[model samples]
Target: MTTQQDPSRETVDRWAFADTVESGSPARKPGVRLGPAIGAAAAAALVVVAATVIPQIRKDPLGAARGTVPQTPTGAPAAQAPAGQAPVGQESLAPQQTPQGGGGSLTYANHAIVGPGGACCSTSGGAWTAAGTGGYPAYTGPVRTSADRNAWYEWNLGRPASGARWDQIKIRLWIPQAQAGAWVRITVTSTAGSASNVATFDVAEQEYQGWYELPATFTIGTPDRRTGSAWVKLTYLRPYTDQAAAQACADGSCDRMAAAQAEFLWS
Candidate 1:
């Protein structure tokens, strides 16, 4: 025979039966925690967010902070100036670039077509004259009447390719009936800049008459810079004779040098 159950106890028994039915699986233990499942879901969300954010940081590190974006200009010309011109100078106006190639070219902001400097001779047409004979329009490679009688010829070699290097220079000069050899200096320099690459040639062979290429090729330019302005100086290492006096005569005037062209070579 069954005993009659209390009403409050019967109520508690019914609630426990409901919880077991909701869980459904008999293998599921009671009082298991939901906190681990919630934590795992949050960690997965953080990984997804990081994947999207890292690329943005790399695309532009300062874009977010600077509030400005950098973009490559569209439809810009490959070269600013025409094929045979250089940009306006940060200093003076550079001359037009020579259109021809094969390495012999001059491009400068402002340049002097080589002329004779210092007092030593007379110039007429394309030759320097001293004594009774005339030499090619050239500076008198003095024989040394004094310390200041050296001859210097200068020309403005245009600026080099923005980053291009000044490799070596090939120069052509003439020496007429010489009693002895003199010292010739090829100096690649910048205006108001110290001497860059300087190469010297000794013309000892009196047989080296007429236009002869300097047997010694000069490698020019300062370190990583262009040979700003190019100048050539001729001084006597061995005393032979000075001709400037014969050309200067009673007047201190002289003629122009039209033959001296110092070339710039680039890689």
Candidate 2:
């Protein structure tokens, strides 16, 4: 029992502006802060003292009950690691978990820019296309303009080849070096209505330049909404030009907008 509060933890938190603390419960420690939730009275109860020091803080001169500690090399509040303290901040980050064969996952054959065909650029209309380019085993197309039809596809997740519905459709894709910073929208249409999920890549993240399952598991349609509908169609919206597709062949940095080995994920 000491009269002094921890110098580092003696902070007046402003209405719980405390996102910096990591997960896992922090136990009551002498210097460690229990946070603002604990009122001043509760916090005051957590002090420790050397054997010779008096338990009463008022009786002790200066609140040095914890003893004279060395100053931090910098004046900033530094993290003090007490003996056997497990390191903080082991966050359970968003998962890009690989789909194992049996875990609520189903396979849906991709309709747009299917893979393992090899890299080549073509044009169906004003929209530029890359069926198989660079042997990357995925689609990589960048929009030559902000047009709606530049890079687009409509694939149906037909009434469950295996069952009536599934957890979600898993689309496997790879973001190549050239495909960095590409924006795309995925829209799913079913009996109820259409829902659109959009995402963009600014850097080569976890699955960048390599085959990776899209971070999100998408719903073709909900059970009620899916009843009358025959199947769910997923459309990719991106704009590109034929000229741009040819240019991509010349340039090594190609923006891949295609996916490979699409499947329905089941529970």
Candidate 3:
């Protein structure tokens, strides 16, 4: 015999079938999550969006390569976070920089030259005196008395490549036999534009004799810093003897007995 189904029972069976299809079968279990596929698709879309946007947000390499970092329209680094913190590609600039001064000691030697100029006058030229052979011009005229004494010679050394710093100077002088025992004086006066700067030294009467070597050391009176030429003058302050001995070249031109030698070292 055929039986008729109840409406409520049919409806409940269809609902149960749909729930199983949507969730899971009774023999099996559901997964830990149901949205991983959607999540992965969303992540891929995000990557595409970043790829399209990052280039626009990044700094221009051309400007950075030229050392002129690209800036925002507001005159700040385009990527600066906020504080003085450097932008993305500038980690190497953290260290800072500063300048540096001079040193070392300098040394020099002393040298001298004599008879650089030719000799003039003969023994018979004047009062007539005899200067030994090796001596240039023979001594002539009366002995140099206190009234007739002058002891300086001046010359030009031209432009100096390395001018003298004047730490120390050694002067070697030669006086006539008649002038021996007289006070030998040496004065160094600046002949450059500033002539008033002068240095003076007196060889005592006791020290005055034939062939004397005087080493006078002095600090250079401030540097003149004058680039051009300068003159050096040496003068004798006092005359040695009071009487006029025969045939003395101390007064007149004496290539023989009167001469001066000097040596110096500078920094």
Candidate 4:
């Protein structure tokens, strides 16, 4: 499920100061000048013009012109529309133990993005560790991001763990109630090597009410099976996005705990 907090409805209307005409007030009649009579008439005409235009200018107390208002990133009024896509309002999808079509082995892994000195940019969750063979690097609890949007918590399913003949699979997740939209992304990959085969999906924010329980599934089609890679990777794209989104609902520390508990199950 995705969420959105509409600022217009939420934001308090600000008070505006009324404007005064810069030119002299019309109450001051044409001054008696040392010059000719024509000069006096010209001064009177100027006052008439100011009187006409100043009233129109004062009509727009906020300084905005007719038919114009500040807009959002996408050409629509920022006050009325959300940035990028429209806000998601539905509940999170429910968890399902059984895969859509059924029958497959499943494994789970956890990762966080806290880097050197613990900046905590995108990382979430508690400590994580793995045990396996075939030089498959078990994804340690917190993965690091280098601006590539490509940090992953990897898992392996070689001969012993996964039968070589099984050609189809599905992946699911336990998304936190708080990070419904702002900062979370989901991605899947077919290789542990540098040039990994991959797929990605974006999660959006949801409305405020109750926590969301979403279960997402993806099919490993025939083509992916033909490639012959022995490992799979699940990544939390832009974990910071998740942090920010979830923070909207809860405190930063609370949000981190929520994200850490997020589960990734495959079948």
Could you give the C-alpha RMSD of every candidate to the true structure, in order shown? Answer: 31.4, 20.9, 34.2, 21.2
Candidate 1 stretches greater than 4 Å from native: 1-113, 116-133, 137-166, 178-195, 216-227, 240-267
Cα error of candidate 3 at position 188, Å: 0.3
Better of 1 and 4 by TM-score: 1
Best model per TM-score: 3
CA-lDDT, candidates in order: 0.39, 0.38, 0.39, 0.37
Select the stronger candidate by TM-score from 2 and 4.
2
Model 4 per-residue lDDT tens digits across residues 73-134: 69777553345443343223334477344333343222222222233232423243221221
- TM-score between model 3 and native: 0.32
TM-score of each: 0.30, 0.31, 0.32, 0.27
The reply for model 2, stretches above 4 Å from the true place, is: 1-125, 129-149, 164-169, 174-181, 190-207, 220-261
Which of the numbered candidates is closest to the native, going by highest lDDT?
Answer: 1
* Comparing 3 and 4 on lDDT, the stronger one: 3
Prediction-by-prediction clash tally: 11, 28, 1, 15
RMSD of 2: 20.9
lDDT of 1 by residue, 100-181 (tens): 4443333322222222332322222222333322234453433211123344444344444453334444455545434223
Which lDDT tens digits does candidate 2 get at residues 1-267?
111111223634333233676699878877765667776657556443343356555565664444555355685444655655533333233435794443232444333333233232222223433433422444343322212335443334344433423335454444444433233443433232454443332222212455545454454454212332212222234333344545643442233344322233433
Worst 10 residues of 2 by lDDT: 1-10
What TM-score number comes out for model 2? 0.31
Q: What is the RMSD, in Å, between candidate 1 and the native fold over all Cα?
A: 31.4
In model 1, which range of ten residues has the least summed lDDT?
1-10
